[model samples]
Target chain A: GIQVEQSPPDLILQEGANSTLRCNFSDSVNNLQWFHQNPWGQLINLFYIPSGTKQNGRLSATTVATERYSLLYISSSQTTDSGVYFCAVPGGAGANSKLTFGKGITLSVRP
Target chain B: DVKVTQSSRYLVKRTGEKVFLECVQDMDHENMFWYRQDPGLGLRLIYFSYDVKMKEKGDIPEGYSVSREKKERFSLILESASTNQTSMYLCASRVMGGGFPEAFFGQGTRLTVV
Candidate 1:
């Protein structure tokens, strides 16, 4: 089993601020994903980056698989960005690779 | 859009009652999973199915069981609910592939056992 840890357990930011969240895993992973759990408790897919970088609007993520770490960046944040951000990876190899999730970083973007 | 639907948004049940949480996916994904989320413990997998009639236990599957009678449906059954079982349950679906595709999740069912 792989262990995933997310940093900055809690964060508070004003609208228009920028912040970065990080996730570190204990072992090599074939899958890495970033998710946003909004206030309404819907887990929204942000990026499926096992390696390299990807951007979607104001959100972007980079995963350095070689380093076993990933970063999620939020720029010009808005109140709507307030919620918990999670990073996940499969537990191990083979057909039973169920995803294991980090505790998540709670972000509060105040207006 | 891809969607994983859970049957309930909130539920209240007695401690010894049997409880069933239903999940369905529209994308015809090969993998479906059930997870419970607590305040600080994050999302812990309870059970998962890679195909119809196939299932596997996850990290914390002690008091839970699952059934996958059809490809699109997966059900989590609590033999006898307990106060400790009260938490947010999430259902997710994903395609079976080497790359490990992103999983689509349901809005989550918040259950309380009294």
Candidate 2:
């Protein structure tokens, strides 16, 4: 079983600020995904970066597969960003690729 | 648009009741999964099916059973629902392809066993 660890379990930020959330995995991964669970409990896909870097609006993510670590960056965060950010990786490097998720980072953006 | 739809958004049942959670994906994905999320446990996989009539146990599969009779539908069944089973359940479906498969999730169903 591969372990996924997320840093800064709890986070609070003022609006218009910036933040970075990190995820580290115990073993190699075939895929890595970043998800945002909103207050309504809908998991929104943020990024599908197994490696390299990608940006979507104010949100960007980078996964260094060689280092077994990934970073999610939010720039000029707004109150809508208040929720839980979760990072999930494949449970194994094989073909099945069962996703194992971290405990998640709780983010609070004050308006 | 690609969507995964769960049968219910909220449910309440008594202990020992048989509960069924249904998930359907419009994308015709080959991989479907069921996961339960607790306060501190994140999202633990209960079961996943990669194809029709096939199933595999996940990290926390005790007391949970799944059925994938059709390619578009996957069901999670609880033989006898217990209080400990009360939590948010999420259903996801992913297209089986090369290296870039991304999972799409349903609006979670929050169930409580009384």
Candidate 3:
């Protein structure tokens, strides 16, 4: 089983601020994904980056598979971005599609 | 976009009662999973089904069981619900392929057992 650890368990940011959230894994992963659980408890899919870098609007993510680490960057954060940011890696295999998730980073964007 | 619809947004059940949480995915994905999220335990997989009529136990499957009779639906059943089983349950579906297959989640169901 792979282990996922997220840094800065709690975070607070003002509007228009930028922040970087980090995730470190213990083993090689075939899949890596970032998720945002909004205040309404809807788990929104942020990014599915197994390797390399990708940017979506003001949010970007980079996964260095070789180093077993990933970083999620939020630029000019808004109040709507306040939620629990989670990074998940591979868990089960063969026919099972599972993800092993970290404890998650709680982001608070103040007005 | 993939849509995973859960049966209930919130449910309250009494102890020793049988509970069923239904999940349906519109994309016809082969892999469907049920996970329980707690305060400190993060998200723990309870069960998953890769194909019709096939199921596999996940990390926390002691008080949970799953059924996948149809390709698009996966149901988690608690034969005899207990107080400790109260938690947030999430359903997800994913495609099976060679590359990076992303898993899509539902809007979670918060269950309270008394």
Candidate 4:
């Protein structure tokens, strides 16, 4: 089993501001993913970066697999970005690839 | 577009009652998963299936069971519900292979065991 810890449990930002969220894992992982739980409670897949970096519009993520850490970046934050961001890492192998998630970072973007 | 649909968005059950949560996917994915999300603990996997009739235990499977009778459907069952079982249940599906398989999730079912 792996332990995941997320930093800055809570964050508040004004419109057009930027922020970064981090996740650190205790063991090596073959999978790492970032998800955004919108106000409506829909878990949206933001990034699946096990390593390297990826960007999608205003959101980007980087995972340094060697260091067992990942970062999620939100640029020009908007009110719509206000929600909880979660980072997950899966351990074990084969069909039972279970994901262990962090406590999550709650973001509040004031308009 | 891939769609994961959960049978119920909200449900209430009495203690010791049997409960079933159904999930269906339209993309013909080879892998399906069930997870329960709780405060502070985030999401914990309950069970997952790789193929029809095949199942595996996850981190937290003590109170949950899953069934995949068909390729497109995965069901999570609670033999006897308890008050502690109250949480938001999410279903997800993903491909077996390829680079960084992204799991498409359902809208989630908020269950309360009273």
Candidate 5:
């Protein structure tokens, strides 16, 4: 089983601010995804970056597979971005492709 | 639009009651998963099915069972619910091919066992 850890268990940012959230895995990961759980409990897929970099709107993510780390950057954060950000990695490098999620980072963006 | 729909948004049951959580995906995905989210524990996998009539145990599968009778539907069953089983349950579906296979999740079902 691979362990995924997310930094800054809780974070608060002002509107128009930029922040970076990090995820570190205990082992190599073949599949990794970032999710945001809104206040209403809808888990939204933010990114599916196993490697390289991807940008969606003001949110971007980069995964360095060799280093077993990933980073999510949010630029000019807004109140709608407030939620719990979770990072999940599949078990081992080549397994059943089931995701093991981290404890999640709670984000609150104040406007 | 691709969607995963859960049967209920909230539920309350007494201990020893049998509970069923249903999930349906319209995207025709190859993978369906059931996970329970608890405070400080993140989301713990309870069960997942990659195909109809097939099942696999996840990290925390005790006191839980699953059925995938049809390709579009997956069900999570609790034969006898306990107080500790009260938590938020999420259903997700993903395709087999594609980059990393992003999961589409349903708005979670919050259950409480009295």
Candidate 6:
């Protein structure tokens, strides 16, 4: 099984600040995804980047598959971004590969 | 848009009581999964189904069971609920593909066992 590790288990940022969250995987992965669990406990899909870079509004993500690492960037952070950010990847190969998630980074954006 | 709907937002149950959490997807995805999220443990997979009438056990499936009678619906069953089983349960659905596809999650069902 592949292990996913997220850095800075807890983070706090001021409104309009920028921050980066990282995720490192122990083994090669065919699929990688970023998720945001809001204060209400709803898990929202952020990005599905197995490799390369993607940008969505003020949020961007880059996955260096060769390095077995991924980085999520948030710019001009807002109070609404206060929640848990998670990284997930399929545990193994084949169609039955289930996603294994990291503990998550708890982000607090002060207004 | 992909929509995953959980039957309940919150539930309270007693020990030894049988409980069922229902999930339905509108996108007709082939893969459906059940996961439990704790305070610091993140999301742990409990069970998953790749197709109707097919199922697979996940990392933490000892106290849980699942059913996939129809392509659009998946159910998680707890035979005898216990306090330790109380947590937020999430249901997700993803399309069947060779590469990693995006999974859409439901709002989650918070269950408390007493």
lDDT tens digits by residue: candidate 4, A11-107: 9999999999999999887779999998767799899888999999999999998999999999999999999999987765444465678989999
Error of 6 at A105 (Å): 0.4
* DockQ, cand. 4: 0.55
Could you arrange the candidates by TM-score from highest to lowest? Answer: 6, 1, 2, 3, 5, 4
Where is model 3 more than 4 Å wrong at Cα? A92-97
Candidate 2 global lDDT: 0.93
Q: Which DockQ values do the candidates obtain, in the order shown?
A: 0.77, 0.67, 0.65, 0.55, 0.60, 0.82
Report, for candidate 2, the interface RMSD.
Answer: 1.7
Question: Per-residue alpha-carbon lDDT of model 3 for B73-112, expressed as tens digits?
Answer: 9999999999999999999999876554899999999999
User: Residue A59 error for model 3, in Å?
Assistant: 0.4
- Candidate 5 wrong stretches, greater than 4 Å: A93-95, B97-100
Which 10-residue window in model 2 chain A sums to the lowest lDDT?
A90-99
Worst 10 residues of 6 chain B by lDDT: B95-104
Q: For model 6, what is the alpha-carbon lDDT of residue B27?
A: 99
Runs of candidate 2 with Cα error greater than 4 angstroms are B98-100
TM-score of chain A of 2: 0.97
Q: Is candidate 2 or candidate 4 better by lDDT?
A: 2
Model 4 TM: 0.93
User: lDDT by residue for model 6 over A19-76, one digit each (tens)?
Assistant: 9999999999887999999887889999999899999999999999989999999999
Candidate 1 Cα misplacement greater than 4 A, ranges: none
lDDT of 4 by residue, B13-93 (tens): 999999999999999898899999898888888998988999989888998888899999999999999999999999999
Could you say which candidate leads in DockQ?
6
C-alpha lDDT of all candidate models, in order: 0.94, 0.93, 0.92, 0.89, 0.92, 0.94
| lDDT for B49 (candidate 4) | 92
State iRMS for model 6: 1.0
Candidate 5, B1-114: lDDT as tens digits = 789999999999999999999999999998999999999999999999988998899989999999999999999999999999999999999876534477899999999999
Q: What share of the true interface contacts does each candidate keep?
A: 0.72, 0.63, 0.58, 0.53, 0.63, 0.79
Per-residue lDDT of B36-88 in model 1, one digit per residue for the tens? Answer: 99999999999999999999888899999999999999999999999999999
TM-score of each: 0.98, 0.97, 0.97, 0.93, 0.95, 0.98
Model 6: colliding residue pairs: none
